[model samples]
Target: MIFLAIRYLIERKRQTLLTFLGVFLGTMAYVAVSGFFLGFHVFIVEQLVNNAAQIHIQARKDYLSAHQLDQAFYENSYRHVFWYFPPSGNLGYLEVQDPQSWYERLARDPRVEAYSPLLTTAALFSLSKISVSAVLIGCNPIQQQKVTSIADYVVDGHFRDLAVGGNRVILGDELMKRLGVGINQTVRVSVGTGNASPFKVVGRYYTGNRFADSQAYAAINDVQRLNGTPNQVNEIGVRLKDYRQAAAIATNWSRIAPERTESWDQQNANILSVFRIQDALRFSMIATVVIVAGFGIYNVLNMTVNQKRQDIAILRSMGYDTFDVVMLFFSQGLILGVLGGACGLFAGYFFCRYLQTIPFMPAAPGNPQGYLHISLDSAIYIQAALVALISSSLASILPARAAGRLTPIDIIRAGG
Candidate 1:
C-alpha cells in the first residue's frame, strides 16, 4: 500500500509539488509571523517591567457625594434640593497621611523587594534663557535604584549623584536637549509661584519614552523642600520579589490600605490591550493561510481519485479491501504533511535568524544600531507543524473515502 501510494504521488509530480508548497508556506508563515509579533510583545513588556515600578501606591483622595454635598450646604433641611451646577473634585490634600507606617509595612512584607517614596510636582525648569515646564520627581536615589532600572538608563554621570542631595538633579535626555544644558550645569527650578532655586544637573538619562524623558529627578527631601511640603510623600513605588505576582498583591494591598494601589499591568492596560489585538490578528492570518493550503490538498487529491478510478477497480478486484485502498490514498497525505512540515520548520528557523541580522534603529538614545526582536520559541514551531499535519490529514479524508467506495462494477459501468 505504501509503495503504491508513493507511485501514485510520483505520477502526478507537478500537482504534488504544488500541494506540498502550499502546506510548507503556510507553516513557515505561521512560525515567522508569530515569532516577530510575540517577540515584540515580550520586548515591550520587559521594558515596562524594568523601567517602572511593579506596584504603585498613591495618596488616596475622597470626594463628597451629591447627598453629602447637599447636607454640607443645607444642613439636611432640604432633602430634595437641586443645584444649578454640580460640585466636582476631591476635598483632601494630595499628600499621603502616613509615610512611616507604609515604609515599615513594606519592609516587613516578604513580597516587597524594595519601595521608594516619591514627591512629584510640576515645575518650571529654566536655563540661562530657555524655560520648559516638566514634572519633577523626588526620590531617595539608592531606594529608587532598587525599585526601578533608572540607574541603568543613566547615559552620562551617575544616578547616585542625587544621593549627595544638596540641590542636585538628573535630567532626562530630551529635557537636557530642550534646555540646552549638559551635566554639571545649573538649572533654576520653581514650583508654582515660589521663588526659583538653583539645582545642579548631575546626570542625564534616556528612557526612550518621550514623556518620561521630558521629566527630571531629585532627592525626596529636596523635592519636598522645593514644593514647600516638607516630609510629605505623594507616591510610593514598590518592587516585588516576583514581578508577575504584582497585580494580585496590589489588589490585596488596596483592600487593606487607604492608598490607591495599582500594578504595572493595570497602569499600562491600554498597551497590553494592543498586544492582545496583535495576537488575534496573528492567529487570524495564519488560519487563513492554513485553510487555503487545506483546500489545495483537497483539490489535488480529489482529482487524483477521479483520474485513478481504473487502478482502484483493479486493486479492489485483486482482493485489496476498502480499508487498504483508503490507507493507500491517506498515506500519500501523511507523507506530504511530514515532509512539508519538517522542511517548513527548518526554513522558518533560518528565516527568523535572518530577520535578527537585519539592521534596524531603536528609538532609545545611545543605541545606534539595533536589530528586530524575533522570538524563536519552541512552541511556535510545534504549533506550525501541528497545523500542517492536521490540515493535510483533514483534506485527504473525503477523497480517501471516495476512492475506497469505488468497485470494479462501478468502473466498468463508467466505460473506463
Candidate 2:
C-alpha cells in the first residue's frame, strides 16, 4: 500500500513538491521567529539580572490620610483616632534599624548566597571647577560584587579601590570624565549636613546607564558618616543560590522583616509587559503561517483524491479494505510532513547561527560587542516538527475519507 502511495505521489510530482515546500517554510518560520524573540528576551533578562541585585531589601513604610480620605481610615476609641500617623514624624520610614540581626538571619539561610548592607545618600561632587549633584552608594565592596556585576564594568580602575582607606570613592566612568579628574585625585564630597569633606578618587566603572554611571560608591562607613547616621543602613542587596525564586522569596521575607523587598522582575514590570506583547505577536505569526501551509497540503491531497477515484474504486473491487484506501492517500501527507519537518529544522538551525554572527551595535551596559542573542532551545525544533506534521495530517484526513467511500459499482454505473 505504501509503494502504491509513493507511485501516486510521484505521478503528480509538482503538487507534492509544492505542498512539501509550504510545510517546510512554515516549520522553518516558526523555529526562526521563536528563536529570535525568545533569545532577545533572555538577553534583556540577563542584563537586568546582572546589572542589579536580584532582590533589594529596604525599610518598610506606612502612610496615613485624613478626613478627605476618611473612607480608608478606621480606628478604635482607646486613645486612638480615625487616622494614625508615623511616630517618628518623618515622611516615611527612612532607615532599617539593627541590620546586624537581619544579617545574622540571612547568614543562617543557605539560599542566601551573599548580602551587602548599603547606605544610599544624596551628595555633591566638586573637583577643580566641575561639580554635580549625585547619589552616593556606600556598601561593602566584596559583598556588593557578589550581588551585582558592577565590578566587571571597571574600565580604568579596580572595584577594590572603593575599599581603600582615607575616604576613597569610586565613580562611574561618565561621571569621572565630567569631573575632569584621574585616579587618586582629591574631590570635595558633601552630604546633607556639615561642610564639604574631601574624598579621594579611587576607581571608575562604566555601566552605560548615564544616570547610574553618574553615581559614586564608597565604603559603608564613609556613606553612613556622610548621611549623619553612623550605623544606619537603609538598603540590603542580596544574591541568591537560585535567582529564579527571587520574586517569591522577596515577598515572604518582606512580610517577616521590617522592610520592603523587591525582585528584579517586579522592579522591571514595564519591560516584561512589552515582552508579553512581543510574545503574542510571535506566536500569532507562526500560527498563521502553519495554517496557510496546512491549506496547501489540503488542496494537493484533495486534488489527488479526485484524480485517483478510478484507482481507489479498482482497489476496493480487488478486496482492498476502506482502511487501506484511506491509508494510501494519508501516506502522501505523512511523507511530506516527515521530510519537510526534518529539512526545516535543519534550515532553521543554520538561520539562527547566521543571526548570531551579526554584530549588535546597541550600547548595552555590560555587553561590549553587543552581539544579538539567539536561543538554541531544543523545544523550538521539537515543536516545529510537531506543528508541521500535525497540521498536514489533519489536512489529509477529510480527502482520505472521501477517497475511501468511493464504491467500484458506483464508478462503473457512472462510467456507463
Candidate 3:
C-alpha cells in the first residue's frame, strides 16, 4: 500500500511538490521563529539573572504610630512642645538584629551558593568641576563577586581592589564616561551632602545596562562610614543552587528573617508578564502557519481522492480491504511530511546560523556589535517536525476515510 501510494504521488509530480512545499515552508518558519524568539528570551533571562540577585533581602521597615507620638509629646511636654511634626527616619539594618546568625543560616542552607551583604547609598561623583549624582553600592568585593557576575563585567581594574579599603571605587563604564574619568583618576565621592572624600578609580565594569552602569562600588566599610551607620548592612543579595527555586526560598526565608525578601522574578513580575505574552504570540504564529499548511494538504489530498475514484473502486473489488485503501492515501501524507520535515530542519538550521552571525545592538547602551542570539535548542526542531507530521496526518484522514468507503457500483454508475 505504501509503495502504491508513493507511485501515485510520484505520478502527480506537480501536486506532490506543491504539497511538500507548503509543509516545508511551515516547518521552516516554525523553527526559525522559535530560534529567534527563544534565543532572545534566553539572552534577556541571562541578563536579569546575572545583573540581579535571585533572592534579595533588605532591611525591614518600621512606622511611627500615634501612641509613640503621644509618648514623645508627653516626654517633651516640659519643653513647651505644641503641634508636633516629627522628622522622617531611616529604616533599620538587617544586620542590627543578628549578622552572625544570618551568615550562619546562609551557610547551613546547602542550597545557597553565595551571598553578599550590601550597604547602598546615594553619592555625588565629582571630577574637578564636573559632578554627577550616582548610586554608590558598598560590598565586600570577594563576596560580591561570588554572589553576582559583577566581576565578569569588569573591563578595567579589579573588583578585589575595593577590598583594600583605600577609598578606591569601581565605577560602571557608563558612569566612568559620564564623570569623564579613567583608570587611576581621582574623583571626590560624597554620601548625600556629607563630607566629600577623594576616591581613586580602581576599576570599571560594563554591564551594557544603563541603570546598572549608573552605579559605583566601594568597600562595605567605606560605605558604612559614609552613611554614618557603622556595623550595619541594609541589604543581602543571595544566589541559590537553582535560581528557579528563588521565589519559594525567598518566601520561606522572609518568614525566618526580619527583612523583606524578594526573588528576581517577583521583583520583575511585569517583565515576566511580557514574556508570557511573547510566548503566546510565538506559539500562535507557528500554529497559524501549520494550520494553513494543513489546509493545503487537505485540498491536494481531497482532489487526489476524487480523481482516483476508479482506482479505489478497482482496488476494493480486487481484494484490498477498506483498511488497505485508507492506508494507501494516509501513507502519501506521511511521505510528504517526512520529506518536508527533513528539508525544513536543514533549512531552518542554516537560516538560524545566518541569523546568529548578524549583529544587533540593544537600543539601550551596552555591548555594541553584539551578534544576534539564536537558540538551536533541539526541542524546537522536534516540535517543528511533530507539528508538521500531526498536521499532515489530520489533513489526510478525511480524504483517506472517504476513499476507503467508495463503492465499485457507484463508480461504475458514475462512469456510465
Q: Which candidate leads the pack in lDDT? A: 1
Winner on lDDT (1 vs 3): 1
- Candidate maximizing TM-score: 1
Better of 2 and 3 by TM-score: 2
- Candidates 1 and 2 compared: the better one by TM-score is 1
Candidate 3 accuracy as TM-score: 0.90
**lDDT (Cα) of model 2:** 0.84
lDDT of 3: 0.85
Model 1 CA deviation exceeding 4 Å by range: 62-68, 75-79, 365-367, 414-416
> Which digits, one per residue and each the tens of the lDDT, describe model 1 over residues 1-416?
88998898999999999888988888888889999998889888888897899999998877866566777778858688887767777976598778899999999999899999999899999998799999999999999999999998898999998999899999999999999998888999999867999999999998878899999999999999999899999999999999999999999989977888899999999989999898898889678656877787788889989999999999999999999999988888888887888898999999999998876746464344577888998999988888888888998899999999999999999985
Span of ten consecutive residues with least summed lDDT in model 2: 69-78
Candidates' C-alpha lDDT: 0.89, 0.84, 0.85
User: What ranges in model 2 sit over 4 Å off?
Assistant: 66-91, 363-366, 414-416
Question: Where does candidate 3 stray beyond 4 Å?
Answer: 62-96, 362-368
Q: Write the per-residue lDDT of candidate 3 for residues 1-416, one digit (tens) a residue.
A: 77899898988899888889988888888889899889988888877887778888887777654344554548756355444665455445434366677888899999999999898888999998899999999998999998888888887878888998978899998898898999999999897656888899999888777888999999999888877888788788899989999999999988987888899989988887887887897789678766876787788788889999988888988999989999999888888888888898899999999998887755322445688889999999999888888888988899889888888888898891
Q: What's the CA RMSD of model 2 in angstroms? A: 3.5
Better of 1 and 2 by lDDT: 1
